[model samples]
Target: MSFDDFYHAHFRGLVVQLRAYTGDVAQAQDLVQEAFCRVFARWDQVSRYDDPLAWTRRVAWNLAHNRWRRLRTARAWLLRQREAHVAGPGPDRVALEAALAVLPARQRRAVILHYLADLSIAEIAAQEQVAEGTVKSWLHRARAALAAALRDTTEEAQDA
Candidate 1:
C-alpha cells in the first residue's frame, strides 16, 4: 500500500495503542506522529519489511518509553528539592504516574505491553527483541515492583 493509504489506515489504531503507554491521548497522538515520521524518513527500508505495522507500533512504543524516561529524570530532580514541591494536594494521577515513572524501562515496557496492551509474552518478546523467557522474567519483576510501588492504591482503579 502507498504511504498515504497506509498511514490513513493504521494511524488511529497506533495512536490508541500508544495511549496505553502514555495514558494521554495528546501524547499518544504525538507518539504516533513521531513513529510515522520515522517510518517515512526510512520509507525505502520500512516498505521492504514484512510487517510495517509492527515496526510502526514498536517505534511508537519505544518513543513513549523514552519520553517517560526523560520525564522521570526531570521529575526526580524536582522531587529532590523538598522546598520546590508543588504545594497543596495534587491529583492521584501524580502518585500513579510517579510510581510508573520509577520502574526500570524494560520492566515497564513489559508490563505495559502485557497488561496494558493485552499482548502475550511472546508478542512482547518479539516487539522488544528479547526471548520469551526474558519477557516473562520482566513481567514477574514488574508485577512485584508495581505492587510494592502502589501499595495503597486499588489496582482496579488504574485501568486505562
Candidate 2:
C-alpha cells in the first residue's frame, strides 16, 4: 500500500492505542505524529515491512515511554525543590521570586538550579549543556543582580 494510504487507514487507530498507553490524548497524538514522521523518513523500508502499522505503534509507544520517564524525573526534581523550601509561600518567598524575575533567562535558570534546586555547578553545567565556567558566570551574575534588587527593596521598605 502507498504510505499515504497506510497513514490514512492507521492514524486514528494508532492514536487510540497510544492514548491507551500514555493516558494522555494530546501526548498520544503527538507521539503518533512523531512516529509517522519517522516512518515517512524511512518510507522505502517501513512501507516494505510486513506490518508498517505495527512498526509505527512500536515507535509511538517507545516515544510515550520516554516522555513518561522524563516527566517523572521532572516531577521528582520539583518535589525535591519543594522540600528544600518552606511549606507555604510567605512574603520573603514572594520577594525572592520577584528578584529572580528581574534576571535574564539564563541567569535566572542558573540561580534556580544552584540555589533552589540545590544542584551542583557540574550538574547545572551538564543540564544546561554548557561549560561549567559558563554556569558559574551565570550564577555569579544572578547572585549580584538578586542582591542589588533585594537591597533596593529593603531600602525602599525602610524609607516607607
What is the C-alpha RMSD, rounded to one decimal, of candidate 2? 10.6
Total clashing pairs for each candidate: 0, 0
What's the TM-score of every candidate structure? 0.52, 0.52
**Top model number, lDDT:** 2
Candidate 2 off by > 4 Å: 84-160
Local accuracy of candidate 2 as per-residue lDDT tens digits, 3-121: 89989999999999888888888988999999999999999998888888888888988998898899999999989878455578976778898999889999999988898899999
Give the least accurate 10-residue stretch of model 1, judged by summed lDDT: 151-160
* Residue-level lDDT for 153 in candidate 2: 85
lDDT of 1 by residue, 1-160 (tens): 8899889999999888888767899999999999999999988889889999999989989999999999999999878876855676565767667777889999988888887899998899899998999999998888888777777565545663
lDDT of 2 at 125: 97
